[model samples]
Structures are given as structure tokens and as C-alpha cells.
Target: MLSNPYFKSVLWLLGFGGMGYGLMLLTEPNAEKIERIKASGSNSKQSADDQRKALFMKRLQEAATTGAPVYRPQPQVDKKDS
Candidate 1:
């Protein structure tokens, strides 16, 4: 087998190719977390009621310290009647 050039070269090339592929796989493993990020992004918008409550509480806190008027913002006017 030492004198057969074809067999030696074929085996050598195969071994090198396998080592390269293995290294690549090890360095960059798989991950599929895009679905979680996309789901959270869509749910980031706070509801109108929650926003109003938060703002009211903030105003109340300020009124206690500075005696400022505590007022909630007006409700949004929905233009679409359909």
C-alpha cells in the first residue's frame, strides 16, 4: 500500500476534508431562537387601560410631593368606523 500513490492520496484528501468539516460544525453550532424574539416583539405594545393607569399613578405621586394636578390623558379617538 505504501507504493500505491492513488490510494494514499485519496485517503489523505478524505481525512483532511472530514477534519475541516468537523471543525466548522464545532465552531458554529445550531440555534433557533428567532420565534421567541418575534413573539415578544408583537406583544410589546401596552393596552390603553394599562397605560392610563400607569400615567394616573405617576401623576398622583407628583401631586403628593409638588401639589400638581393629577390628570389622565384623554382616550384616543378611533377614526375607523368600520
Candidate 2:
């Protein structure tokens, strides 16, 4: 069974995976840093989403006031008869 090429490859892959996982665990960030990172990430994401929503609503209101099409289609180009 040990002489089988497939089994050998599987064992080699498992060994490398275990070592990588162990390294990740050893080098993992402290809990406080993780929490801070999570908090900042979430706040930034929320603020970005809110800004985007506000901008979109502003544009929609402007379009409505000007009676412009909310969704504009590309203008068709006329082919020149060379």
C-alpha cells in the first residue's frame, strides 16, 4: 500500500497541508487586533454603502426634476454608405 503512487501523493499533500495550518495558527493575529480590524472594516463598509446610497438618491432626484430618463440607452450610430 505504501508503494502505491496515489497513496504517496495523498500523504505528501496531507503533510504539507498540516504544516501550513500549523504555521497559520502560530502566526495568527492577537484577539484584540482582530477585533479592531473587524470593527474598522465593518464601519468603513457601512459608511461607504451609505454614501453610495445617498449619491444614487441624489442623482435620481436630479433626473426626476429635469425629466431625464433614469436609464439611458446608447445612441445608435448610422453606418456610412462608403
Candidate 3:
């Protein structure tokens, strides 16, 4: 590998070019994507609401087939007389 005359020079130039591009990125400011992300909140809320509605519909379907209530109660916790 050391027999090639341009080996060391090629590597040196490649490393310097990579560092230059990195420095350029560091000095440049990107704001459009940041603002878009900050403004993108409604989709998550909408998705969660849609999922809950779908789950409610599924439970309703099950309840309509059976005669049980769609809502189930949590198990009662027994407490000792403190």
C-alpha cells in the first residue's frame, strides 16, 4: 500500500474535506424542520382519540353480542383495620 505515491496525499485530502463539510454543518442553522416538529402536536392527540374510539366500538360490538356491560369493574381491594 505504501508503494503508491498518491496514497498518503489522497488520505490527507479526504480527511480534510470531511472535516470541512462537518464544520460547515456546525456553523449552519436549520430552523424549518425544527419549527415543523414543534407545530406537529395535533396528529398525536387525534391518533390517540381515534384509537380510544375504535376500542370503544369494539367493546360495544362484544357487549351487543353478549348481554354483559361493556365496562368492567376493578377487583375490590381489602384493607385491614389499621
Candidate 4:
């Protein structure tokens, strides 16, 4: 009955316990499967490189349309004396 103190306490405890259990399940790490999939040395990097090249080509095409000169920055490398 709704008037029973014991029944109210049990319901409250159950509600809090279920919420804590749900939180634990939600926060638990599930990244191991993703790491394992990525660890196979797949084509992710190649796809990324292809995307970058495609973007560069698109930019070049836009520059050609606008008659703009494309400049490439050189990498800074240290000169080592042997």
C-alpha cells in the first residue's frame, strides 16, 4: 500500500540501485574493440591520404579558375654536419 513506510523505502532503494547500475554500465569503457580493429594496420591512413590529395587537387582547380598562383611551403630541416 502507498501508506506503508517499508514499501516506500524498498521502492526508493530499488530506484537508486537501478540508477547506479545503469550509470556504471553506461560509463564502462568499450573502446577495446575499436582499438583492435584499428590495430590491424588497415587502409585508414591511405584513405586519409587520398582525402588530403583530393582536397589539394580541388584547391588547385579553384586556384586555376581564379588565375591564382599556388605556393607550397618548404619543410624546415636541420643541416647536420657529419
Top candidate on TM-score is 2
lDDT values, one for every candidate: 0.78, 0.88, 0.83, 0.85
Q: RMSD per prediction, one decimal?
A: 17.9, 10.8, 13.0, 13.8
Which has the greatest lDDT? Answer: 2
> Model 1 over residues 1-82: C-alpha lDDT tens digits?
8789999999999999999999998876334556666667664597988788888888889788986555654567889978
Better of 1 and 2 by lDDT: 2
Q: What is the lDDT of residue 16 in candidate 1?
A: 99
What's the distance in Å from true for residue 43, model 1? 25
Alpha-carbon lDDT of model 3? 0.83
- Report the error of model 3 at residue 71, Å: 94
Question: Which residue segments of model 3 deviate by more than 4 Å?
Answer: 31-82
Q: Write the per-residue lDDT of candidate 2 for residues 43-69, one digit (tens) a residue.
A: 446676798898889989988898887
Quality of model 1 by C-alpha lDDT:
0.78
Worst 10 residues of 2 by lDDT: 40-49
> What TM-score does structure 4 among the candidates reach?
0.37
Off by over 4 Å in 2: 32-82
Number of residue pairs clashing in candidate 3, backbone atoms closer than 3 angstroms, sequence gap of 3 or more or interchain? 0
Ranking by lDDT: 2, 4, 3, 1
